[model samples]
Target chain A: MLNIENLHVSVGDKPILKGINLQVKPGEIHAIMGPNGSGKSTLSHVLSGKSGYTVTQGQVTYEGKDLTEMAPEIRAREGVFLAFQYPVEIPGVSNIYLLKAALNSIRKHQGLSEVDAMDFLTLIKEKVRLLEMDEKFLYRAVNEGFSGGEKKRNEILQMAVLEPKLCILDETDSGLDIDALKVVAEGVNSIRSPERSFVMITHYQRLLDYIKPDFVHVLAHGQIVKSGGPELALELEEKGYSWVENKQAA
Target chain B: MTTQTASRYTAEYSKIETTLPGGSLPWLRALRSDALKQFSGCGFPSLREEEWRYTNVSGIEKNLFEPRLEPSDNQIDKDWLENYRLADCWQIVLVDGYYSAEFSVLAGLPENVTIKSLKESLEAGDGQIEPYLGKAVGIDEHSFVAFNTAWFTDGAYIRIPAKTVLDKPVQLLHVVTDPNRLAATRNLVIAESMAQAQVIETYVGVDQAYLSAAVTEVFVEPNADLTMIKLQCESEKAYHFGGTYVKQARDARFNHHNFAFGSLLARSDIHSDLSHGSECHLNGLYLGVKRQHLDNHTRINHLEPYGISRELYKGVLDGRARGVFQGRVVVAEDAQKTDSEMNNRNLLLSNDAEADTKPQLEIYADDVKCAHGVTVGQLDEKSVFYLQSRCVDEETARNMLTFAFANEMVTKITQKSLHDLVLAEVLKRFPQQGIMQDWL
Candidate 1:
C-alpha cells in the first residue's frame, strides 16, 4: 500500500535519510529493523507528514496518491495511522472523546454515518477487553499519568478503533514488558486483514517472535542495506549489527 | 488639587445628596458622608497605585452615570430577563438598584430565614442589619467600595439563622436598562452557627452603556458553610466593579466562583479572612473578546493556626481583548501549619490579545506550606498536533483544547442548572462554527 522511491529527507540543515526505497503490497506486514540513529523513526514521521522535515529528493506514494502533499490531519483522514513511540499526555481531553472524534471524522470522510454513543461504547468495550485496559481508562484524560505499557496499549486500541488502511507502528514494542508485548501483538494480529498493511519499526528481534512479518529489512547509515525473509531477523540477532557493518564495509 | 477623577465623583455625589438611602439613621449618614469625603480625597484610583496599575479607569471617569433612584420598568425586557434566571431557585430581582417585589419570588421560602429588601430593613429599624452591614468590608479598602457605600440606594439582605440548612440556592438578579444608568447596590449575607447556604449573584443589562458598582459582605459563623457564585454577563458596552468580602469564623468553610464574561471593562474582587481551622476556596474563569478588558483580584488571609486556602484563576483573551489577574495571600505570624496553594493560568488566542498576571504571597508564619504558579501563553503546539493527529482539523483541534482548558473550571460547579447555564454562557463567547454543539 506504500511506495517509497529513493526517499531522501533532512531535518533542518542536517540530512538524515540519504537514499531509501521500499514497497509493501496489500495485506503484507514488513518489519524494519535497525540500530540506534538508523533513521527508523524519521521514516515514520516523514511518512505521516510531521512538520520540521524536508524531503530533499524522491517521493512517497500511498494508495496511488502523493502522500507528501497532504497535511497531517488530511493524511490521517485518508486512513494513515502512526502509533507514536512517546505518546503525548493531554491533560484535559478524555480518551473516549478523542477516540470518538477520530472515528467520526474518518467515518464522515468515508461518507458513513457517525457511530451512536451506545454502539460506540460497545465497540470500545470490546476493544478495551482485547487490549486488557481498565474500563476506567476511557474516562481518564488522554495518556495523562499513564504507564508506558498503558500508553502503548492505548495506541493499539486507537488503531483498532480507526481501522486505518496503513498502520505505522513506530517503536510500539519499546518499553513494554513481555506480558504487555504479548497483549499489543495480539491486538494487532486480531485486526489484520487482506486490505490492511503494517510497517512495524523495532530495534529487537524479540518483538518479531510474537508477530511474524512477511519481510525483514535492515536499515543502516540512512539506507536500507539488507532485505530478506523472517529468518533474517534471527540471523541478525545471533550475528549482531556489527556483522552487517563488516559485510557492508567489505 | 487632589485628582480630577476623584473631584468629578465628589461633584456627582453632591448633586444626589438628598436622594441617598438611610437618611434617618445618623450612623448611616455619617458613614456615607465620610465615604464621600474619602472618595473625593483619593478620587478614582490611578494607574500609579500597585493594585490599579494595570487597569485604567479614565474611560469610566469621563462618563457620568447617575444612580437610578427609582424603579423604572419602562425599558425592561421580560423575555431577555427570563434567559438568565434559573428555574430551581428562589429569585430576588433588582431593576436599576430598586427592589421589585412584583418580579421577586419568595413565597416558598423557609421560616426563620429572611430574604428581604435593604430598603425594608432600613425603614423598619436597626435590629435586622445594623450589626453586620459594614463589618466584613471597610469603606476605606478602595474607591469602588467607597462609591458603593455612599451611593447605594437598595440591595438584597439575606440571613440564615443558626442550625438551618438551605436546600436550594438564592438568586440575586441585578439588571439595568437605560444608557448611562448606574446600578449601585449593597448586599449582606449571614449564615449563623452550623448553618449552610448557597448564594448566586447575577448581573446583566441591556445593550446600552451603563455602570454597575456592587459590594457584597458575607459573615459565616463558627462551623458554618457558604458557597457564593458571581456570574457577570453584563452588556458588552457596560462597565462593572464588584467586590465580595467575607469573614469566616473558626472551623467555617467558604467557597467562591467568579465568572466574568461581559462588559467593556470589568473588575471583580473576592477577599476572605480565615479564622482558626477555617478553609477557603476561590475559583474563577474570565473570557474576553472584542476589546473587552476583564480584571480579577483575590485575597486570602490566614489569621490563626491550621487554616487552609486554595485558589485557581484562568483567563482566555481573543481579538484585541486584555485580561488581568492579581492574587494575594497573607499568613499571619500566629497562623502556623497553614496550607495554601494559588495558581493563575492564561490563554491568548490572538496576536493582539494580552494577559497580565501577578501573584503575591506574604508569609510571616514559619510552619506553613504555600505555593503559587503562573503561566501566560498560547496553546501548546505539541498538544495541538496531538489532537490533529487524531483526525481533528487544526481549527477544531484548537477550539477543543481551548474549551478543555476552560472546562476544568466548569466541572467544579456542583449545581447542575448553574453548571449548564455557565457552560452555555461560555459557549456563546466562542465562535459558534468552530465548536460543534451536538458533539459536546
Candidate 2:
C-alpha cells in the first residue's frame, strides 16, 4: 500500500533522515524503534506532507500516486492520516464539529453525499464509546485543556472515525498510562482490516507489548540498521538501543 | 475649518431648538443651552484630541445629517423591525430619535416599573430625571455627550423600584429610516437599591447614510445588580456613536456586553465607576469588514476600597477595515485592595486590515493589584495546519478559525433569542462555509 525508496529528508541545512527504504503491503503494521534524534518524527511528518521539511532525494508513493505532491488536506482526503505526537489545542472548534467536517470532506472527495446527521451521530458515538471517552468531550472545544492521555485517545478516536487507509501513529504511546495504552491499542486493533495499513513510530518497546507489529525496524543515526521479527523488539527492550547503535557503528 | 463646521451646526440649531423635548423646563433649558455652547465650541471630536486621535468625525460634518423635529409618520415595515425586536421582553421603540408609541410593546408591564418616553416623563413635571440626567456623565466628558444633549429629541426612561426584581428584560430599539437623518437619543436606566434587571440597546437602520448618536446613563444603587447589552448593527453607509456611562454604589454589581458589527464608521465608549466592595465586568467584541472602522474605548474607576473590575475587548478586522481599542483602569488612593485586570486582543485577516490597541493602567493605591495585556496579529499557523491535516481546506480552515475567534465573545450572552440574533449577525459578516450554526 505504501513504498519509500532512498528517503533522504532534511530540515533547513541539517540532514535529519539520511537514507531509508521501506515497503508495506495492505493490512501490515511496522514498528519503527529509535532513540533521541533518530529522525522518527521526520519520517512521519514527511509522509503526512508537513511543510518545512525538504525531501532532499527520495520518492514516496501511496496507492501508486506521488504522495509528496498532494496538499495536506488533499492527502488526508486521499486516505493518508498522521496522528500528531503533541496535538494542537483549538479553542473554538468543537471536537464533534471537526469529526463531521473531516468525514464529510472525505465522502465528498469520493463523490459521496454528506453523512446524515443522525447517522453521523450514531457512528461518532460508537467510536467515542470504543475509545472509552465521555460524550461531553465531543461537544467541548477540540483538545482544549485535555489531559495527555485523553489527547492520545482522541487521536485514536479520530482515526477510527475517519478510517484512513494508511495511518501513521507518531509517539501515540508517549504520554499514555498503562490503561490508556491498552485502550488505544484495542481501538487500533479493532480497526485492523485487509485494506488498511499502519506505521507505528515509538521510542520504547512498551507499546509493542500491547499492539504487536508484524515487523520491527531499528532506526539509528538516520538509518534503519536492523530489521527482524517481533522478537527483535524484546531483545532491544532487554539490552537497550545501544545494542543496535553500537552494532551499527562497528 | 473646525470652527466653520461647528458654525454650520450652530446655524441649524435655532430651527430645531424650540421643538426639542423639555423645552418648557427652565433647568433643562439651561442645561441644553450650556450643552449647545459646548458643542458649538468643539463641534465633533477632532483627531487633534488625544482620545479622538485614531478616529475622525469629519464625515458627519460633510454629510450634514439633519434631526427629525418629530416622530416621523413614515410607514415602517413591521417584518423588518421585528428582526431587531427581542421576543419576551418589554420594548421601547425610538425611530429617528423620537419615541414611537405606535410601535412600542410595553403591555402587561409591572405597575411599579417605570418604562416610558423621556418626553412623557419630562412633560409630567415629576422632577425625577433632574438628579440622573447628566449626573453620571456631564457634557464636559466629550463633545458627543454635548452634541447628544443639545440635539436629542427623545429616548427611553427606565427605573426599577428598590428591591424589585424584573421578570422580563427591557429592550431599547433605535431605528433610523431616512437618509441624512440624525438620530440623537439620551437614555437613563436606574436600578434602585437591591434591585435586579437586564437591559438591551439595539441600533439598526435602513440601507442609507445617516448618523445615530446616543448616550445612556446607568445607575446601580447599593447592592443592586444590572446587566446591559449593546448590539450595534447599523447600515453599512451610516455613522454611529454610542456611549454608556455607569455608576455602581457600594456592593453593587454591573455587567456590560458590547457587540459592534455594522456601520461605515462607529465608535462606542463604555465607562464605569465602582464604589466600595462593588464589582464591574465589561466584555466587548467588534467585527469590521470592508472599509468599516470600529473603535471601542473603555475605562474603569475604583473609587473606594475592595472594588473589583475586569475588562476584555476582542476585535476581528477583515478587508481594509481598521479597528481600534483603548482601555484604561484607574485605582484611587483610598481604594485599598482594589483588584483590576484588562485585556484587548485583535485579529487582522488581511494585509490591508489594521488593528490599533492601547491598554493603560494607572494606580494610586499601594495595595491595589492591576494588570493589562494587548495583542494584534494574524491567526496561529500551528492551528491552521492542525485543521488542514484534519481535512479542512486552507480557506475554510481560516474562516473557521476567524469565526471561532469572534464566537468566544458571543457565547457569553445568556439570553437565548438575543444570543441567536447576535450569532446570526456575526455569521453574516464572515464566510460561513463549513461553519454550521448547529455545531454551536
Best by DockQ: 2
Worst 10 residues of 2 chain B by lDDT: B431-440
Tens digits of per-residue lDDT for model 2, A52-90: 999999899999999989989999999988899999999
TM-score of 1: 0.97
Query: What does candidate 1's lDDT look like per residue over B216-288, in tens digits?
Result: 9999999999999999999999999999999999999999999999999998999999999999999999999
Q: Report DockQ per prediction, comma-separated.
A: 0.69, 0.74
On TM-score, the candidate that comes out on top is 1
Which ranges of candidate 2 are over 4 A from the true structure? Answer: A238-250, B433-435
Fnat per candidate, as a fraction, reads 0.59, 0.76
Which regions of candidate 1 are displaced past 4 Å?
Answer: A239-250
Instruction: Single out the weakest 10-residue window by summed lDDT for candidate 1 chain A.
Output: A241-250
Q: For candidate 2, write residues B27-103 as lDDT tens digits.
A: 99999999999988987888998888899888987888999988799888889988888998899999999999898
